[model samples]
Target chain A: MSNIFPEVANKVPRWILFGLTLKVLAIIAGLYYYFTPSYTRAGYQPVQPVSFDHSLHVKQVGLDCRYCHTFVDRSEHSTVPSSNTCMNCHSVVKADSDKLALVRESYQTGESIEWVKIHDTPDYVYFNHAVHVNRGVSCVHCHGQVDEMEEVYHAKSFTMNFCLDCHRNPEEFIRPVDKVYDLQWEPEDPEWEEQAQAFVHDWKVMPPESCSGCHR
Target chain B: MNRIITVVYIFLIILVVSVLGFRGSKSRKEPLYLFPDMDRQARYEPQGENPFFEDKMDDRLPPQNTIARGNALDRAGVFSSGFDATELTDVAFNTGRDEAGEFLKELPIEVNHELMELGRERYDIFCAVCHDETGDGNGAVKNFAPPTLSSANLLTQLYIDQSEGEIYNTISYGKNTMMGYADKLSPKERWAVVLYVRALQRAANATADDIPEAKRGELGL
Candidate 1:
């Protein structure tokens, strides 16, 4: 007991220990939020079997979203293009290209390519593409500028809070029905804010913010 | 001792800042979950194989005769007849062509204002994406150079004189690279779409006299 420990350590105040613990906790919280899939999945581009380039098809080729997602407006889920749909053009355009091997196989065998789903919500949450697309919500709103994306990824987190942020104030997102497919569409005019507000009223887009609205 | 405490504080600050800067980074590994809660719940994924069922396939077919909701044709007054030969004289609702193998000229349903409006709306939804809004065939997919419905040499005489039944057949069964709408659209809606296509053809090849005399001046016709 001849002062083996440093006298300074024994004399240390409890407040400093408390402060260090608080700092360590803050660091843990920061790391937790940073590592969540919502942040990491934003740029989570998966390698598709066909190596399909949305930029080439959508921007340069000018294909509409409905061309591949044929059932966006008619069905709750946006159906992926069937092999027949792919063969519509691939039968001639890139019929023998090495890159289109899977496309050819799928078309010939009548089997699906098994494209990986990037933007998946919790099984509890129900989402409808028809409701959003019909109400003038552009695909760009959630999917981002898909026309520019070489490979598509989840542009937005489909968390309850992220969804509620829009459902609460839909006027900020509403646009004309015709501009739904235009990725570059924006409120350019000075009165656009007022116009968007008017549109929300005119279309009667009252998205529910309650838990049952989506959970059910 | 004070220097050591300051060093610890600096290290903690650096750690927090570095973690915060990792936002939007891509990770191949799955995210850490505190509460799995319905996320990792036991359920069969689409096309998943399971040994629990006799078939061992998760994708089970619907019961022998139990139709899915909204799929019963009789309820919707939509019949899925391939050919209507009940009345040899009546060719309506028939997918078969006449003795000459030519498409029938008369539409099965009468054309009216309401039907035309409905046709236009449905046409915009289903056909306009590929057929183009003006039916000029300059649909958004021009890069692939899909066939146009408004080609003067193609649609003007060809589609215009092809007969309504032929066009209807094309819409129902699909022609060439175009996918058929028999599954997506009902029989009556298909007829309405045929009428709308005819209307588009007329508009595409319209002459000066085809317009109303009063509206001619406004259009500079």
Candidate 2:
């Protein structure tokens, strides 16, 4: 039998082929960026075991970030506070609330309540809380205004490029070492930027952009 | 040529459709790790259970008297006569109450400039959030127009009448909505905070006579 529609095969219009190729390229480019880890993980707010409201504790109650993250400035990892920290106030404040049963049980039994990690960095990337915090990076810079968050979520894409953006220009985000914990602090005046520059100068802050900076 | 074009077009369409149909975008699933190097390690995590230990806990307790590095002074026995009911004079640990269970009227630790400085620093970190920087109790926490320090709150005549030891007790075992700092602060630091609170009260309530002789001129007292 004759080849079905033989003329259509060899003499197909070049413009249609070009148009199809362009569409395929567009689809690939769109999906590639859309499905990137940064885009996919930007707002991954997992449902926590407890409905802990950061807004209630941090914003309304005006608790400092360090109140719960007790080791941010001293240790490599910023650990989640123990149940005892919650019981410190809950034992008296909301002593009988059913919502805090898990906290009470954990505190009493000396068992830990498993808090879901929000800002999870990959194992290959070594992130140190003390280094960043002690060097004048405020908690809000990377974590967003957690005080305003009703339920805490990962605020930034903790990707390599995201980290390198700040690591490359340390001065723009730097503040006075004392003001590092002031999550709400802003550049009050031109002098504030000047002060940050001075701090960067005085402390000799060099956020390394090398592979070993985080990879090690 | 036509068959080849059709095959290429179909392949591209299939790739695009499959990628687009991946899953619910809002689902909280992590992306698949194509090269998940060290993403999940075998190392023990903090507070994670371990069969190796008798208690099955990864966090091991220090072997009995392992005094934390900075807490060495906590065990120096600064108090000569505390809750033991002894009549010693040099004791700084008063347990913050009298026999009647009322707050003590005297501070066990001596109030000095160094102690006040330490107190100021610790207070700023721990108490300022709720108690505010000036200890007016108007800390941003309550958001309900908390009473100023000199008013009828914790710094007034009723509270001031209590001994410094009583204040220390209040710090150790928090009263009302305030959390106890026994875990967060050392005992000496608590006493220093008490002294600092007193100083804050004095500063807030100072009259012409309370000001120092030299600084009085600057204040136009």
Best by DockQ: 1
lDDT of 1 by residue, B25-141 (tens): 554444445455886446765545468987565667889989876455444244336644333234455463666777778777668988888688678866775677788666555
lDDT of 1 at B102: 73
The A-chain TM-scores of all the candidates are 0.90, 0.90
Model 1 misplaced regions, further than 4 Å: A1-11, A21-25, A28-32, A35-37, B5-21, B28-34, B40-102, B109-153, B176-189
Off by over 4 Å in 2: A1-24, A27-31, B1-27, B30-34, B46-57, B64-118, B128-133, B136-179, B186-192, B212-220
True contacts kept of each: 0.28, 0.28
Candidate 2: pairs in clash: A61-B141, B80-B91, B96-B165, B104-B163, B105-B163, B106-B163, B106-B164, B136-B149
Q: Write down the TM-score for model 2.
A: 0.72
**How would you encode candidate 2's per-residue C-alpha lDDT over A162-197 as one tens digit per residue?**
788888888889887777877888887867777777
Q: TM-scores for all candidates?
A: 0.79, 0.72
